[model samples]
Target: MSLIIIGSVAFDAIETPFGKTDKIVGGAATYASLAASYFCKNVKIVGVVGEDFHQNDIDTLNQHGIDTTGLQIKAGEKSFFWSGKYHNDMNSRDTLVTELNVLADFDPILPESYQDCEYLMLGNLAPQTQQTVIKRLKNRPKLIVLDTMNFWMDVALNDLLETLKLVDVLTINDEEARQLSGEYSLVKAAKKILTLGPKYLIIKKGEHGALLFHEDQVFSTPALPLAEVFDPTGAGDTFAGGFIGYLAKVGTINFNNMKNAIVFGSALASFCVEKFGTERIINLTEEEIAARVKEFVKLSSFNIA
Candidate 1:
């Protein structure tokens, strides 16, 4: 099975309760591609960067078996840049700067070769851009997962709602859920969002963990607590990567299968927060991942008598 990820490839300057990074290779696609590559051999990335973006980053993706032919490099302009400062809890951050640069006018052009993808992950982006990618797919993927943020909810709620109709699963944090659904309660928000179109809704609660809701059923997983969280950047995209990558590896999208995907995702994300950017995911060995998954099994496993 082939998986396609469409989102950011940019630079970020971040400050967290743990420490700070002046400039680092980050963004949605970087994290998602790295995490997903651990499980899927054929991961196609679709995004845009500029001259200043490092070529080694492209090589990093390619070395991990992520096809980056779909990634565009705008010759003269600078890449997108974001700066943020996290609060003491590291659960939320305040934006300090947002320079779209080359990404400001991005019109994603998916390569013809990426047309047959079986799983599609649309990471955070403008609603219209995400919708365009979906409409261009020649055949509908088995699962189309979407992630968005409050920025879109504030600026383009109507377009965001329209795009939600095309996805099978939607992943957003608890705050974004409340913003999108205008409901204080997550249960009510999930119920409201499900009616919009997606069959599954994941409400990410950062350090608190994540929750999955399908129909009337719900599953919750806890985030791994670490002594240090060097950088909180890209953790969410890492979660998405692991979640979708596991599903692709198993070649199934059923509810039972998705449960495993969630656990895999949570485990991968746990590794992400331990370091800055994609450092942890890059050099991680398969044996280590297997061991972590076993740990997840132990933490969540229970026998009903």
Candidate 2:
């Protein structure tokens, strides 16, 4: 089954305690597509970039077996650019710059070939844009997962809620979950959010871990502890990618499988924070991923009699 990803594919300038970069290829779709490529075969991305975006970067995605046929390159315009600096904790960040050149008027145009994918990931974007993609699909995907931020909830609550109704799963951080559901307790928030429509909710807690809530059941996955976290950008998107990628590979949609997917996603996201942007994830070997996943099993496994 093919998986379709829709979000921004653009440029970013990042700064952290470790170091800084002028500009790198970084976006919600970029990270998600790269992370998903390792688990699923037919990964197609639908997003907009600018002519300034290097063809080599596009080729890099192709190297990973990701289909870029649906990526639109806007002639003469500049790709969206963001600059941010992370605090010493690495969990909080401040935005220094945001240029929405191409993204300002983004209109996702899905190629006919991408219309039938079994899995769809709507990465962080305007709620209207995410909704547009779902509406454009001739047939609903077997699973639809959405990732959104507090920004959208603050500006477009109605549209975001409307889009949530069309999705099967929703992924958001702890803070956004509270804001969306108006509940301090995540369990209560999940219950309130579930009434809006999605059958599942994943609350990403960054370095702490991720929690998956479905019906009355809950699964918690811990983040791998490391000597250092060089950068935190794109880690959340990477987690989302791995979560859906594993599900797509196994072709199952059950709570048990989703629990495993959360572990896989956390493992992949652990790699993401080891370096800046997508540097750590780009050349990861299967062996490395397997070993990392083993680490996760060791970190959380226990038998209670």
Candidate 3:
């Protein structure tokens, strides 16, 4: 079984109360592919970059068993770039610059080798682009997870809604959940959004951890309280990476497997915020990750009897 990730691959410049970085390799697919490599070796990545994008980064991912055969490198153009300044809380930020560059008119075309993937993760992108990928797949994946932001909801609600219908799981932050459902309470919001199509809803609350809702059942996982959060740019995508990676490793999507996947995802995300961009997740080890998941189990464990 293989996992396929679809999202942007670009450079980012970030500043926070803690510190700053000049320009780093960062994007939805970049972090997702790195984090997922920990659990599963064969990961196919689909995205558009430009001639200016570093080939070394692509080489690194390929060496780690990530297939970039589907990665589009547009010649003679600059890659997409984003620069933002984070607030003291580390949860919110202001976008100072966003250059669409080659991504402005990106139309992802899956390579022939990418068509057989079993797990499809549609990272935050144009809903129509995501739909195009789904259409190209010869067989429906065991599970299709989608990650989207409020930006798309604001600009393309109809297409976003259509994409949601094709997916089994939808992951979004707290504000996006509220805005999508028009409900202040998360419980009510999840309920309302469930009606929108996805069987499972994952609400990512950065520093606050994440909530998983399916039917009448709900589970909450706490985020590790780190001494410092260097960058939170791609943590969400990293979470999705771990989530789908674990499922692909286990070869199932039952609730019990999903429960473990959530813990795995949270553990990966904890390491993500510890460094700038995808730095920490890139060199993470299985032993270290298992230790963190053990910590999470202890943190949330209790005897109510």
TM-scores, all candidates, are 0.97, 0.99, 0.98
Write the residue-wise lDDT of candidate 3 on 178-213 in tens digits. Answer: 999999999999999898889999999988899999
| Predicted structure with the largest lDDT when compared to the true one | 2
Question: Of the pair 2 and 3, which is ahead by lDDT?
Answer: 2
Question: Can you tell me which runs of candidate 1 are displaced by over 4 Å?
Answer: none
lDDT of 3 at 33: 87
**CA displacement after TM-score superposition, residue 71 of candidate 1 (Å):** 0.5
Best-to-worst lDDT order = 2, 1, 3
Q: Which 10 consecutive positions of candidate 1 have the poorest summed lDDT?
A: 223-232
lDDT (C-alpha) at residue 147 in model 2: 95
Better of 1 and 2 by lDDT: 2
What C-alpha lDDT do the candidate models reach, one value each?
Answer: 0.92, 0.94, 0.91
Candidate 2 residues lying further than 4 Å off, grouped into runs, are none
What's the lDDT of the predicted structure labeled candidate 2?
0.94
Expressed as tens digits, the lDDT of each residue in 35-58 for candidate 2 is 999999999999999999999999
Q: State candidate 3's TM-score.
A: 0.98
Q: What ranking emerges by TM-score with the best candidate at the front?
A: 2, 3, 1
